[model samples]
Target: MLPPELPPLPALTRAEGELIDRYLEVLDLLGRINPARNSGTYTGLRAAQALVTKAAALRDALTVMHNRGESELHGETLARALRVLDGERRAGLVTVPPPADN
Candidate 1:
């Protein structure tokens, strides 16, 4: 069966798009590094190492936006964009999971 069509991405400025993309990348790395979620130290360590680079990229994205005079954040619009990009699920992975039942 054909999968349902995904919603179109919300309109965003170039910097905003970069910011979202970089932010998601960082979230993915964080999720992998999350001790509660990760099973192995080596895996988490690798993610932690990669996180430094991803975080720098995220910072650069924001810096570009700031330099471009995009001072105020459009929270509602960006929230929509994040939702479209599955930010909630990605971000959730960074959190500690619930305790297992006995």
Candidate 2:
């Protein structure tokens, strides 16, 4: 089974919404590659996979909702974290953290 869907983040502006779409596109393209934010392990693999899967789900959800009029196309808060991660990736920082082996 797939992971649970996350609560949608509403885009507050057209600019932000567009940014979110761009960000999701980037994720769908690149989120699968493990950024190796921690020591390589099973946890890192899962985290990387989760990043790609969840992002693709959320991206699809947003697109469908926008098409169905269930949600705004431009949610300001949507993809805010993604914007941050985008910045971090551009800055050569870790994007996905491995789950703690507890």
Q: Best by lDDT, which number?
A: 1
Clashing pairs in 1: none
lDDT of 1 by residue, 20-63 (tens): 99999999999998999899999999999999999999999999
Residue 25 miss distance in model 1 (angstroms)? 0.5
Full-model lDDT for every candidate:
0.93, 0.53
What's the C-alpha lDDT at position 52 in model 1?
Answer: 92
Tens digit per residue, CA lDDT, model 2, 1-102: 997665555435554455455555545434334455444566566666667666766577567657766554433354454554454454333355547899
Judged by TM-score, which candidate is best? 1
The alpha-carbon deviation from the true structure for residue 73 of candidate 2, after best TM-score superposition, in angstroms, is 7.4
